[model samples]
Target: MTAAAPAPRTPRRRGRPSRTQTETGPATRDRILEAAREEFSERGYEKTSVRGIAKTAGVDSALVHHYFGTKEQVFEAAIEVAFAPALDAPAALEEGPLDGVGERLTRFILGIWENPATRTPLLAIVRSAVNNETAAAVFRRLVAAQLLRRIAGALDVPDGELRAELAAAQLVGIAMLRYVIKVEPLASADPEQIVRRVAPVVQAHLTGH
Candidate 1:
C-alpha cells in the first residue's frame, strides 16, 4: 500500500509584533513629534506628559520614550520643527551684503510669524518656554547653539557672541510683543512695517559700524 498521506501540515504560528520593530525610524519619530506638538500646544509643557503624548499618538508610552527619551527632548524637537525656517537664518543672512543682513534676518523671522502654518506651533513653543523653566532652557539652548552661534561665528567682529545675543534679544522682544502679548500697534501693524522699523536696530547690533 502507498505510504500514508503526509502528516497534516502543522499550522504556522505567528509571533506577537514588536513595539519597537514595528514602528522604527523616521515615520515613527515624525508621528511622535506631531503628537508632541499637539499636546504641548493644547496642554502646555507643564501639563503635557509622555503618557499623554503616547495616548495622542496611539502608541505605548514606552515607545514614545524609546524614540525621544524625555519630554524635554520631545519639546526641543518640536521647537526645532516650528523654528525650522529661522534655523536657516544664518544662510539667509550670509546670502546678502553685510549692510543688508539685518533686513534679511528681520524679514525672515517676521515671515515665520506672519505665516499661520509656522506661527501657530511657534506660539505654542514660546508660550510653554515662557511658563516652564525646563522648556525655557531647551529654547535658550537651541537659540544659542543653533541660530545665534552661527550668526555670531560668521561675523567679522570682536565679541561676536555678545553681538549675536544682543541681536537675538531685539528680535525675541519684538516677537513676544507682536505675537505673544498681542501688544496693540505691533499686533495690528503690518509685518513689513514692523520689519522696516526694527531692521536698523538689528543691523546696528550685528554690524556695529
Candidate 2:
C-alpha cells in the first residue's frame, strides 16, 4: 500500500511580473528618451505630454514616469542623449595643442550636424527650444552648465566664460543656418570647407588673437 502514491503535484500559476522582471532597464529608458526627443521636437515642450511620449514609445505612461519623474526630466534626459558626443568637446581641447582646439571643437560640433543620426534629434531639441521659452531655459541651462562652462574652465584664461560663449554663439549660428534654416550654399557646402573657414574665427574667440 504505496500510501495512495502522493497526489499528483499541481503546476503553480505565474503571477504578475515584478518591475525587475518586466522592465528592460536601459532599452526601455532609451526608447522613452527617443520618443521624448521626437515629441518635444515636433510639438515643443509645452505641448508634449508624458502620455504622448509613452504612446510614442509603445509603453505605458506609468513606465515613462517611473523612468523619468517629470516631463522636464524627460526632456533633459533626451537633450543629454542627443548632445552627449558634443558635450565631450572639452576633452578634444584637452587632447591637442591649444592652437588646434578651435578646429577640434568646430569639427566635433559640425560632425554632429553632418550626421543625420545625431542631427535629427538635435534639430528637434533646437527647434523646441527656439519655439518655447521654458524649453529654451532648459536648453540654455544645459549648454551653459555642461558644455560652455566646462570648455571655458579648461581654457583657464581671463574672460574664458565670455570666450567660450562667443565660440558657442558662432557654432550655434552656423548650426541654425546650415541645419534648421537650411540657408543656401552654407547648408550644402562641404563640411571640411566650413570647418576650415569657421575654425579660425573660433580660434580668435578662444585665444584672443
Candidate 3:
C-alpha cells in the first residue's frame, strides 16, 4: 500500500499515587487541624463540630475521627500544633552545655509567639483556654505530653520534672503577658531584651537556684 497505517499511539502509564501523600497523613492531619482551628476560633468549643472541620478540609467526617478520634481530640491536636514549633528547643540543648540553654529556649519560645505564622493559632488556643476549663485541661495535657515531659528529660538538673514545669509556667506567663494580653513594655520591648531578662529566670528555675 502507498501509505502505511500510522503506528498506534501508546497510552502513557500513570504512576501509582501514594497512600500517605501530603494530601493524606501529615498534610491531611494539618489540613484538618487548620480547619478545626478556624472553626474553633470562630465558634468556640461547644459550637465547633467534627463535621464542620471535615467539610472545611474537604475530607470525610469519619476521616477526621479516624485521625483525631473526637472533636475534643481534634481540639487537642490543634492546640498541640500551636506549640509544636517551640517543642524543638529542648533538642538544641540535648547535645550541648546547659549553661545557655535557657537563652536559646526563651528565644525560641518567644520567637514563635512573635512570628505571625504561628501567633494566630497560639492566640486561638490561649483565648479558648482562658474561657473553657476543658480547653485549659487540653492545654495542660499538651504542654505536659508534648513539651514539658520531653524538656524535663532532656534537662540535667535536680527535680527535673518539677523544674521543667516551673520553667514552663514562667515562659507561659511571659507569653500570656506579651502576646496574649498585649501588656505594655513587655509587649513592646525588643525580643533580645525580653529573652535576656527572662532567660536567666528560666535558667535559675531549671537549675534550682
Candidate 4:
C-alpha cells in the first residue's frame, strides 16, 4: 500500500568518481611543459617544435598548442620552469636585514647553480638561449621580468631596478664563466670564495654604501 514499493530503487549507480577536466588539465599541461623543456634543451629552440613536444609527451600537437600555443610560447613556459628555483632568489632578500641581503641572495642564487640537479636544466636553457634570438628573449624575460625585477622590488631604493640589473650582471657573469663556459680559475675556484668575493660587489650595487 505504501508508495507502490518506491519504484524498486534503480540499482544505485556506483563507481569511482570520475576525474574532472580541472584535475587532469594541470597534469597534461605539466607533461607538455616537461616535454618542451627536454626538446628545447636537446634540440634547441629553432629545431624544437610543438609537434616534437607533443610526440615526446605522448600527446597530440593540437593539445600542445591548446595548452601553450605556438613554439615560442612553449619555449617561454620551459624557460620559466627551468629557472624556477633561481627565480626564488628575490625572496632571499626578504629573509633578513637589508644589510646582509647581498650575501643571502648571492648564496641562494649560487646554491641553485652549485646543485647539479638544478644546474643541468639551466645549462641547457642557457645554451639554447645563446644560439637563438627567440630563445634569448624568453631567457631575458626570466632574468629581467621574473628574477631581477622582483629583486629590485625588494630593495626599496631609488633606481632599484637598475641596481638589481647591475647585481645580476655580476652574478650572471660568474655563472657564465664558471658554470656555463667552464672557464679556468672561476670554474675551478671554491664556491665559498666565489660567494665571498661576489657578495660584497653585489651589495655595493644593491646598496650604494
Please tell me which predicted candidate would have the highest lDDT against the true structure: 2
Which lDDT values do the candidates have, in the order given?
Answer: 0.86, 0.88, 0.81, 0.84
Predicted candidate 4 versus true structure: per-residue lDDT over 78-145, tens digit per residue? 88888889878888899999899889988998999999989988988888888999888878877888
| Model 4 misplaced regions, further than 4 Å | 1-24
Model 2 lDDT tens row, 1-209: 55667878666334332465345778888888889988987887889999999899988787787778878889988888888878888988898888888898999899888888988888888988888887788899999999999999999889999999999999999999999999999989999999999999999999887
Candidate 2 — which pairs collide? none
TM-score of each: 0.87, 0.85, 0.79, 0.85
lDDT of 3 by residue, 53-128 (tens): 9899988787787788877889988877667887787786575678877777787788888899888888888888
How many steric clashes does model 1 contain?
Answer: 0
Off by over 4 Å in 1: 1-25
Candidate 1 vs 4: which has more lDDT: 1
Clashing pairs in 1: none
Off by over 4 Å in 3: 1-30, 59-63
Candidate 1 lDDT, tens digit per residue, 73-176?
88998889887878888888888789998899889888888899999999998999999999999999988899888998777678888988998899989999
**Stronger candidate by lDDT (1 vs 3):** 1
| TM-score of model number 4 | 0.85
